[model samples]
Target: MGMTAPARWLVAVGSLLALTACAGTGGSPGGGTQRQIAVSTAVPDEPVTLTLAYTDDPPSKALIEGFTKRHPNVTIKPQMTPFNDYVKSIKLAMSSAQPPDVAQYNPGAMSSLVPAGLVLDLGPWAKAYGWNDRFPPATLETLSSDKTAKRFGTGALYAAPGGLSVLGVFYNKSLVKKVPKTLGDFETAMQQAKDAGHAPLSVGALQVGGFQIWNALLNVLGDVKQYRSWVYGEPNATIETDGARKAAETLTGWVRKGYVPAAANATADTDAQAEFAGGKSAFLITGNWAAAALEKQMGDDVGFFLMPGPTAEPPKVASGSSVSYAISSKTQHPNVAAAFLDYLSSPEAAKVQFEAGFMPVDTKTDMGGAGLPVEIKAAFTPVAQANGIVPFADYASPGMIDKLTPGVQGLISGKMATAGFLSSLQQSWNEHHGS
Candidate 1:
C-alpha cells in the first residue's frame, strides 16, 4: 500500500518546513564540529550502542534484531514514530545534538536533510561492502541524489534498502478466468467483467491509488528514460509528452466505459482494497504490500501480474519503493551503522525482509513462498534483473502528489479534460523546478 494523498501532502509540507528550519540554523542544525570518518568494512569488537529512528515496523524491528544477533557487542535503540508524525518530527530529531545514528529514509519528506549536509554519503561504504553487487541498481538509484537533493539517480548514495516493493495488478480469480498477457487482453477482460455487471477495476481515485494506476500504465507505454528523467528532476525534463497524454487518456477512457467504479473518487484506498477482497470488483492495481491482507481474505482465489503492455512481450518496467535507511552525519559510530546497512543485503536479512512482507533488496536471493509471494517474485525477478523498476512519479516534486491525486479525480469524474489535467501537473512541476 502506498502513502495516502493527505500523508503525501503532509510530507511535502514537512520537507519545506525542514528546509526552512535548516536555513535559519546557518549550518548543520546541531552546530557540531565536522569530523571526517574513516571508512571501514568491519564492525568494532568493543561494545557499542547506536540509536535508529524509523516509522515502519516489520523490516525495521526484524532487521535490527538480525544485525544485533550477528554483532552481539552492538545494541541498536529503536525510536519508533507513527507515519504521520515521522516526517515532521524526524527532521527535528536528526538535527538535534544526540541524533540517531541511523534513520529511515523518506525521500520526499527528508530530502531537505541532504542539502543541509545532515546525512552521510554512503559512497565509500557502498564500495567497501560491494553493495553494487549486493542490491539491485534500480533500487539504489532512488536512494541516491545530488548534494542539493533536487536531482536523483546520479549522485552520492545516501541510503541502503532493507526491503523492497513493486507495483502490479491483483485479480479476483473467480472474475478474471485467464490472466491478461497484453494490454488489449487486459482491457477486453475488464470490459467482459463490466458486461457481467461487475465493476471491472476497483479504484481509490481520491488518493494515491488513482495516480498509481496511471503510473503503471505510463511505465508500460512510455519511454523509460524520459519518465525517469522527469521524475528525477533532470534539466529540461518534462512530463507533458505524448506517452503521458496517452496514459491519461487511457485512464479516462476506462472510466467512460464504466470499467472503473462510479464511486471511485469518493473511496479510500483501504475501502477499495476491502471491496476487491470481497469480490466486488474483478481487479485492483496496487503494490505487493497489500498481498498479505489480500491473501488472508481471498486465499487461493487471488492472483498477481505485472501490468501488461500493448504487445505480448510486456514492458519490463514497474514503479516501486524501498524501506531504506541513511546514516546521520553526526554519528560517532559511522562504521557500525554502515555494517548494519551492509547486513541488510545479506541472504539471512533477505529472508527476514520477505517474511516481513516486502521484496528482498537482494533480488538474487531465493524467496521461496507459496501463492501471492511466489507470483510477486516471479514478476519482480526479471524486472530487477533488467534494472527496470523506477521510483513513483510523485517523487518528482514536493507538490506533485497534490496535483496527481486531484488531477486523477478530475479525470475520473469528467470534471477536467485530459489536456487540462496534464497541464495542471506540468504547472506544479514548473512551480517547484521553475520554468
Candidate 2:
C-alpha cells in the first residue's frame, strides 16, 4: 500500500526517540570550535565520490542522476532505507566514523543530530549558493533549529527541500456536481453528497487522515502566524485556542451529521483513498504526495482544490512539508554535497521533482501539465508566494502525533468531546514545550 501522511510521521518520530543515545553530545552543528570545511562555489574537476542516505525514492534517485550528469567526475553512492528504519539507521550511520556525505533531513528523526553536531550547518554554503533567494524561506525555516532542536525558524540553515508537498481536498466530480466556492458551500456539498446516499468524505481516522480534516478546517478559519509560531515551538506557544476548539467541534459536528463515515476510525489512510477512488466518498483530504495514485485511479473524474475559507476566496494558508536533505558533519566532500543540494533549486530539478510526484521547492518554475498536477500547482503557487504554506500541526512536537491519532479517533467515534480533544493536544504540546 502507498504510505500515508500519518505513517510518515509515525516512522519519523518513533524511530528518532528509540535511538536517542546515538545523538551527538556536542553543541549545534553550526556552533562551537568545529573545524571548518574548505568548499567552493564551483564543482571540482578531480574525481570525487560521495554517499547519500535517504528514504524518498523518486526525487532522491532522480535528483542524484541530474547532479551526476552535470559533474561526471563526481560519483554519488546512495544508501536507501525504508521509511520505518530510516530515522534510527541514519542516526547511527551519520554518527559513525565513516558517514554518508548527504542525508535526508527529518526535523523529528534527525533533530538530535543538530545538538550532537553530527550534521553540517550549511550556513556558509547557503550564502555561497545564494540559497536565501533560491529556495522558499518557509521551507528552509522548518529545516533549521536551535542547538537543542527545540525551537525553529532561527539559527543556521540545516537542509534544503528537494521537493514540496501540500495538503488539500480531492473531490470526485462524478459524485459532487460542482466545486465549492466557500466553506458554507463546501459543507452544503458534503450534505448533498450524504443526502444522495454517498459518503460525504472518506477519512482515515485510524491515522493522520482524521486530524488532517481538522487541519484543513483550521487552516481556513484560524490565524496562520499563530499556528506557525506554535508549530515552530516559540516560547509560550499553545494549541488550546478558540480556533482549535472550533476546528475540533466542526470535525465532531461532521461525525454527528454522518458526513464522515462512522467506520473511519478503523480505516487507514490508504483505505480512505481507496474508498474515495472507488467512488464511495465524494472527497478526501490529503497531501499532494498521494496525487499520482489518486489520478491514476480516478482520472478526469477527480478534481483538486484548497479548503476555502468563509468567503468566496480560498484561504491563504495550507498545511504542507518538504522532502529535504542535510549534509553530514563528518563528510570529506562538503562542497560536492552542497553542490547537490544547490541543484535542488534549478529548473531541471524542478521538472524532475514534479514528474516524480512532488511539488518542486523552486516555486517559480513552471510545472505545466494536465489534471491534478496542474490543479495542485494553480492552488499551491499563490500560497507559496505568500509564505502561506505551513507545517502540519502534529509536527509541533514528537509526542503530538500520539495525541492527534487517538484524539481524532475519539472525535470520529463520539467517544470524546471537543474540549477533551483540544485539551489532550495541548497537554502534549505543554509536555514538550512548556506553557
Candidate 3:
C-alpha cells in the first residue's frame, strides 16, 4: 500500500514509454525484462524513452508526469486516439517493427488483438508479484484476458484493473428530491415525472452510443431472472430466450410509456452527460467514472441509488471493469513495464485516482479524504459486496455491439416485439462473427 521512491518512478513513467524499437528485438537502453522497470529511485545512466499507445482518455499523461520526476532519464510519450478507434490504432502501432511499450485496452474486444504477437504474457511477472492474493476473484476474471479459451479470455497476464467500477442509477438530485429505491418506487417515480410534464429517464439506444445502456438493462432485470447466454457465451446476445425476452420487454414498455428520450439511440456519450447534467432527464444509469465529470459540472446537486429489481431488498446491480493497463510482449523493457504496473497498485497512485474522482481497484486502500464519487459508489458498491456483479458490454466478444445494439434500438422504438427482437439479435451476431 505504501510506496518506496524507486517504485513511484516506474509507476508513473514506465506506463507511457511507448517509443518503438525494431519488431523482433525490443531491448532498450538498459536491457531488462519488458515487465520489470528499474525503481525510480535509481538515477538512470541515460534517458530511457518509452512510448505508450492507447485510447484518448489514457492515464499516460498523468503517469508520465509522475514517473519522470523521480527518474530524469525516463521519458514517457503517448500515442492516443478515440476509444472507438483504439483497437484499430493499437493494432497498427504494434504491427510495426516499433511497438508501444505499454498500452490501455478493453478486456473483451481488445484481447482478440493478443493473437497478433504484440502482447507479452504477464504470467511470470504475475507469479512474482502475486496479485492473485491481493485482488478479488471476479477482478482477476474481470480484468483478465477473456471468458472463454475458445475466445480471448486467457493467455498471459497482459493486463490488469486500473480503476473501480459498479452499476446503479445516476439521477438528478435537483430534479427529484427523493430517489426511487425500489422497483415499484422507481416505476412510480417515472410515471410521476411524466404526469408532472418532465422526462423521467434518459437513455441512449440503437445509436452508436446507446448500446451499452441497453446491455446494462439486460444485466439488471433480464439476467437476474433467467439464464443469460451472452454473459458466459453459452448462447449469445441474439438468442431470443427468456432472459432476452424479459430484458427487451421491460425496456420497450418503458419506451412506449415515454419514460426515456425517444431519440436517445443517437445520443452521444457527451450529449447524454450534458442532458443528465442539465437536469433535462431525471435519471441516467451509469457507474462511478462519471463522478469526476459530474462534480466538475454540477457539484453536489446529484445523487444515486442501487437500481432495484422487483423484489424485497436493494436490487441486484450490474457492473464491469471500466479499463485496464497492459504490458507489451514486444517491449524491450519488460521489467520496466512490470515495475510500472506494481507502481499503479501502490497507495500513492490509487490515492491520486481516488481523489481525482475514480475508485481504487485495491479494496484495502482507503480514499485519502478525496472522497469516493458518491453517486457511483452508492450505485455499485452494494452489488459488488453482494457478489452480484457481472461483466461489461464487451464481455462476450468484440462483435457484440455491432450485432446487438441496432436491434435494441428497434425494440426501444416500438418497431419490434421482445421475442422477435431477440431472435434477430442471435441471427445478427452469427452473421458478423459466425457461429
Q: Model 3: C-alpha RMSD to truth?
A: 6.1
* Model 3, runs deviating above 4 Å: 1-47, 68-73, 107-112, 146-155, 206-209, 224-229, 232-239, 368-372, 385-388, 428-434
Each candidate structure's count of clashing pairs: 0, 1, 32
Q: Which stretches of candidate 2 lie over 4 Å from their true place?
A: 1-32, 56-58
Compared with the true structure, what per-residue lDDT tens digits does model 3 show for residues 45-142?
56577787767563556655665664567777878888778776776776667878888866443444454445655555555454565444455554
Clashing pairs for predicted structure model 1, backbone only? none
Question: In order, what is each prediction's RMSD in angstroms?
Answer: 8.6, 8.5, 6.1
Candidate 2: which pairs clash?
Answer: 24-116
Q: Write the per-residue lDDT of candidate 1 for residues 52-162, one digit (tens) a residue.
A: 999957489898898898778899999999988988888888878888999999976556787777888788777655677668898889898877777889878989998
Off by over 4 Å in 1: 1-34
- The better-scoring model by TM-score among 1 and 3 is 1
List lDDT for all candidates, in order: 0.84, 0.82, 0.60
Worst 10 residues of 3 by lDDT: 21-30
At residue 250, candidate 1 shows an lDDT of 93
- Evaluate model 1: give its TM-score: 0.92
